[model samples]
Target: MLIAVATYNEIDNLPIFVERLADTLPNVDLLVIDDGSPDGTGDWCLQEAKVNPHIHCLHRQGKPGLGSAIIAAMKYAVAHDYEVMVNLDADLSHPPEMIPLFLEAWEENDPGATVVIGSRYIKGGGIQGWPWKRHMMSKAINFYTRWLLWLPMADCSGSFRAYPVKLLKQVDFDSFLSQGYSFFEEILYHLKREGAQFVEVPFTFVERQYGASKISLQKAMVAVGTIFRLGMKVWFRA
Candidate 1:
């Protein structure tokens, strides 16, 4: 299995992240795709690479969108012939302990499962550290997406997901237009259009305790616009 983390300015959390993954996940190849964080995240990964044979790191020249980082990781996963390519953020919001949940879910429906989503809206799933305003906003977005796009999935904005390589290859990477955090939403659309089997597993959605949030006024507006545009595309096709 190819386990990949897309990182940006996560140097401080790298050590702890790796240690937690090492303890919980066994025999998984660790792939890090760093977009040239000024804090020497790539450099730290390079040093760790010396002793850890399962760890792989890619350092880009500058900051790229998370979509590109995961796409690059998928290309590498394809080159390595991995059956499943899992992608998650390096911000510790995605707990390393949930790796087994994803593995079991995938195996139970293997050869047919296309996507396994680490969900925050299913049973045993809830968010912590988020204010009521933020939580409501997320739920509002989820509801709008479900009504507009007719998607039944609870967390349309989820980033922690695993895809069987074959299903991923079905997506037109070059044609994937969304570059920001909206990429996750776009992927859900593509998968839905292709009739990919999606499984949602419950997970605790922990808020990031460190580092500044990348979300901004601009991204928020863009997210709304993207959803509207995607909803239109889907609606008109019907």
Candidate 2:
């Protein structure tokens, strides 16, 4: 199994996150995809990768997008012959300990799930530190995505997810349109069409303690537009 994290200026949180993940799953390989953080996050990752055999880093020219970073990770996983690849935020928002549960759920399921989502909307799942307005926005986005895309899952926008490499290899990453947060939903839609099985594992989402949020109002609008366009395709195909 391989674990991947997409990073920007996450120098404050990346070290702690990496240590916790190493402690939680000591043997798993880790890949860091950095988008040229001027704050030396990429430099830190490069130094760590040189010393830690389990850690690897990919340096990009500039701030490309979370989606492209993840796509790079997926391609790397496939090329390296990894059986499974897990992706989570570089910030400490997603718990590393829950990764074991994700692997357990994936293994225990009959025939195994192709994608395992660390969901915040499920019964045992919850979020911490988000205001009511942020909470409402999240709920609204999930509901809109589920209804419009005819998606089966409750949490459609979260980034903490695991994918079977075999299934991921079947996807045409070049054809993906989403180069931002919308990639989460777009990838799932494409995978679902490829007959991928999905399972949700509940996990608590803690708000990042360091640095400002990377998400913006403009990105949210782009996500909404992208999902709406995909929804149109779904409707027309039906």
Candidate 3:
């Protein structure tokens, strides 16, 4: 299994992130996709990758979108012959400890678990430290995506997920339209269209403890528009 984390300026969180992953998933290889963070996050990953054989870094020239970074990680995982690929945010919002549960879920299921999602809207799942406005907005986005895309899952917007690399290779990732956070839902839609089976695991999403949010009003607006266009495309195809 290959675990991938996309990072920006997450200097404060990287140490604990590496330590916990090492302690928990000692055998898994890690790919850090850094988009040229000004705070030396990429440099730190380079140093660690030199010392730790399990750690690898991909440095970009500038800050690219979240979607591109994960796509890059996916390619790396496939090229390296990893059976499964897992992606998470680097700001500690997605817990590194849940990796075991994801693996277990993937292994226990027969054929219907090509994708396992860490969902926040499920019964046992929840979020922490977010203001009511942000919380409500997240809920609204999930609801909107589920209805528009006719998706079965509750948490379509989440980035923390595990995918079988074979399932990932079935899709042409270069055809993906969304270049930011909206890519989460768009990719799920594409996978569902390919008849990929999915499982949702409940998890508590904690707010980032370090640095500011990468989301902006402009990005949110773009995501909304992208969702609408994707909805139309899927609806017409159906």
Candidate 4:
């Protein structure tokens, strides 16, 4: 299993995230995808990599989209023959301890369990620190995405997800068009279209305590446009 994380300007959160992940996932290999942050996050990763053999970091030139970082990690996992590739946030919103639950779901070898998502929509799952407006926006986006893309899952917009590399290889990266937060929604739709089965595990969704969140008001525009655009592609098979 490869635990892949996407990060930007996470200097304060990075070390803490790394430590927690290390403690929780002792045997799993970790891959950190760091977008060039002026906060010296990339340098911090380099130092950590020297001490921790299980930790690896990929440095990018600028702040690219989260989807690109995930796709890059997916390609790396596929190339290296990692059976399971787990994608999560480096901001600590997605708890590292529950990773075993995800792995156990895949252990069953059910054809219907290709992607296991850590979801907050389930009974034991909940969110924290989000304003009512932002919270409503997130709910609306997921609702619209579910209706438009027609996925059976309740949580379609979370960043904590684990994919079987074989099923993940079905989609073409060039066909994946989202460049921002909507990338999570788009990829889930694409996975369904390609016959990848996704399962959602209950998880508590905590807000980040580090720097600012990546999903600002600007991402709302991208989310609205990208959702419909990708919806048409999936709904109409365009």
What C-alpha lDDT values do all the predictions have? 0.83, 0.91, 0.89, 0.84
Q: By TM-score, highest first, what's the ranking?
A: 2, 3, 4, 1
Task: Give the per-residue lDDT of model 4 (tens digit) for 1-238.
Answer: 8999888889989888788887888777899888888899889998989988888899998877887888889888988888889888888888888888888887765533388988888888889888899789888988998988888888988989889888777778887778778888888877877788778899987888878887777877888788898778765874
lDDT of 3 by residue, 93-172 (tens): 89999999998888877433379999998999999999998888888999999998998998999999998887777788
Quick one: best lDDT, which candidate? 2
In terms of lDDT, model 4 sits at 0.84
**Clashes per model (N, Cα, C within 3 A):** 0, 0, 0, 0
lDDT of 2: 0.91
Our model 3 lands, by Cα RMSD against the true structure, at 1.2
lDDT of 2 at 126: 98
For candidate 4, list the clashing residue pairs, or say none.
none
lDDT of 1 by residue, 1-238 (tens): 8889988788778778899999997568999998888888889998988989989999887777877788888888878888898787777888988988898889888644458998999998888998897888788878887877778788888789888887776778787767777778888888787788888999998888777667776876678778888899888988
- Candidate 4 worst ten-residue window by lDDT: 105-114
Estimate the TM-score of every prediction.
0.94, 0.98, 0.97, 0.95
Candidate 2 TM-score versus the reference: 0.98
Off by over 4 Å in 2: 110-113
Candidates, ranked, lDDT: 2, 3, 4, 1
> lDDT value for candidate 1?
0.83
Those runs of model 3 whose alpha carbons end farther than 4 Å from true positions after fitting are 111-113
lDDT, candidate 3, residue 100? 93
* Candidate 1 ranges with C-alpha deviation above 4 Å: none
lDDT, candidate 2, 94-180, per-residue tens: 989899998887887633336899999999999999999889988998998898888999899999998988888889999888999
